[model samples]
Target: MTPGIPGFRHARLPGADGVQLSTAIGGSGSPVVLLHGFPQTHLMWRHVAARLATEHTVICPDLRGYGASDKPAATSPDVYAKRAMAADVVSLVAALGHDRFALVGHDRGALVAFRAGLDHPETVTHLGVLDVVPTLDMWNVLHGVSAAVGYHLFLMAQPPGLPETMIANSADVFFGSFLDAWACDPAAIPDGVRAAYLRASAAAVPSIVADYRASAGIDVAHDQADFDAGSQFAMPVTVVQQDWGAQLGYDAAQVWRAWAPDLDHRLTRAGHFMAEEAPDEIAEAIRELLAR
Candidate 1:
């Protein structure tokens, strides 16, 4: 069986819009739900959650269409939109009996956490995002280095059939590339974790592609509408990212400031997978956000 967060118990919880979310529940006290990023599962939160479990009820759920979560057939491009994914998270927390909670997400999960904070401002008390900006800001800032480094976003954004077929034919190499290239300390993602990610991703190619496709199309529209409406997250927010904005010639904090008025943005020395590469820092950031 797959190893998991040491003290947590697993469950397949019914989620928003008929998605079944694979979740890990543990701890007691104020609730904190953690969402994982691309090419990974809730297992990505293993190290971080273990530490937080001592003081908070930590709930980690695989975003629908990832890991053991049910990947429903896409009825439309918007089906995998972060708004829908965010709803799944909100519902999972409610089912567990928490009316409101702090939320932390890494990568794509951060997008969902962002949407959750925006769409349900009263429910998400504090939001922490790791390694990403808002979806609209991400696309808006892309040019030169940002475009080059983020080529996968465009690749997966293509019309469905092509990206799925190509990625599936060389699944291991495609998925492993992210795990290998994004980590500054390769030891942070050991063989076992890497293997699990590869296995899960390879088997869910289409759904994964659809998830990214939504970002390029419907997700941007949703974010744009929110942007035009002058809506911003009211809850306290913390963001830690690799200095992609500085490297890519954009101001990361400046871009994030528009979405989060009460924002604490920092650059990380750790690579893209900061939770594993620097669990103490991520855990402490969540704790500090919760304390706020």
Candidate 2:
């Protein structure tokens, strides 16, 4: 378990479609659910959740196929689609006695949170995404450098057997690459936390690849439909990301603004793992989004 994060207790809850979600619950008042990104678990929310818990009932869940959550056999990418993952979050919070709540996510979890806001606007009161753009924009904005930076997206998008087998054989290198490269301060993620993330990701290699594979296929289709319908996020939205647009030659804020009419976008020097590298900043961003 993470060192501090006061008053939080963990549990396993049933998610949508028989998947199980390992969750951490604490505090009281208005509810806020935090979701972790790839190669991490609910523990990634250690500092942010603890702070939010003081004023809000903070819930952190390991998205299905990550951490201690159930990794159902992948029949198709559809099973790991962000839509399905988003459903898991909605069902999990509802089961935990929250009909509506503010939602926050980092990295892969941010993609799921994006889907949750689009799929259940009434249920997600406010949305906060750290270090990511929407899935569709993510693909559209990619060119030379951005594509190289997000190499895993294409590596995992490859036909099933190869990516999984390749990743499984070199799990440490595959997962460790991100842990080492994606942090502004490598020391921000404690050795213990880093070890835990590596272990969990290594164990769930195939399922994790399936999750990314879905983004390239089914998840894109869903986002396209939403975009075509001109669906907009009806809630307050906050986005924090590295100046990827500057590095990648696109306007990150403009991309997010297209979907969220009410948006608060900020560029940070913090690396991809912003929640861990700058927890106070991330927590304050969520509070600001909630206050809106």
Candidate 3:
């Protein structure tokens, strides 16, 4: 195990789109793949992945376009679709010589994990989706100011160049909005950590837009395919989310129920970045889910 973060070794992963990616892996035993959300990298799972690694082999990788991954020139949201991302995880695990493993994701990562569970049900033994519902549910729930909270989704999904330029001009302000506004406790994001996210996001403008752009386009289509197929994950599943968002019309868990029949849903008081703001609680949930 790694000295401090049980799972934090840097590795390269081959993505489904023929892109080689930078990944962080640690821990030992049953393999566990950790996926990060938007504007963040694999580092988001630092704490939870570490704790899980103490018993299970934990792996956290930067999604295709976010961190040190190959930023392919793909404007068609299909290129960045959840199905493609899920394929990336499958290939990544097989690259590590595992036929199947446990899967966990937060924010955007949660969507990718959802796709993985739906598309390759045989490869995921268990799944943990944190703070998100399926893409189709999210689209229907967007109304009034709730829609404003995710304005970037529509903005970034635009024709490109413009969103990239605007985000670059105010990268810190753009990325920090969630880190600051959505935190149950603002202190969860220390200056250094906040700076790290800001720096990484600022440097990757085009890929950043592609990541969000994928949501409105191919991602939704992927989710619809699952919905049309009436697909649901057969593996044991756990969903941990903030109750406030669900109450505000997001209705996250309700959507999750349609996709995952076997799930332990827990609503908490933590903010959006539950893994960082409530590591202990998040770790407990992960541990319990993995044990099951």
TM-score of each: 0.98, 0.97, 0.94
| 1 or 2, greater by lDDT | 1
User: Model 2: per-residue lDDT, tens digit, 1-292?
Assistant: 5443568888899898899998889999999999999889888899888888889999999998998899998897679999999999999988988899999999999999999999999999999998888899889988876579889999999997999999999999999998888887999899888888988999899889999999999999999999999999999999998975545687788899899999999988888888888889988999999999
Per-residue lDDT of model 1, residues 1-292, tens digit only = 5668898999988888878999999899999999999889999999999999999999999888899999988889768998999899888899998989999999999999999999999899999999998999998888875488889999999997899999999999999999989999999998888999999999899899999999999999999999999999999999998865445577888899998899998887899999999999989888888887
Count of steric clashes across candidates, in order: 0, 0, 2
Top candidate on lDDT is 1
Winning model by TM-score = 1
* TM-score between candidate 1 and the true structure: 0.98
Clashing pairs in 1: none
**Better model by TM-score: candidate 1 vs candidate 3:** 1
Task: Please provide, for model 3 over 112-219, each residue's C-alpha lDDT reduced to its tens digit, 9 standing for 90 to 100.
Answer: 998898888889999998988778888888888768988888899888789989988888898888787788887876776677777777777788788778888778
How does residue 13 of candidate 1 score in lDDT?
88
Of 2 and 3, which scores higher on TM-score?
A: 2
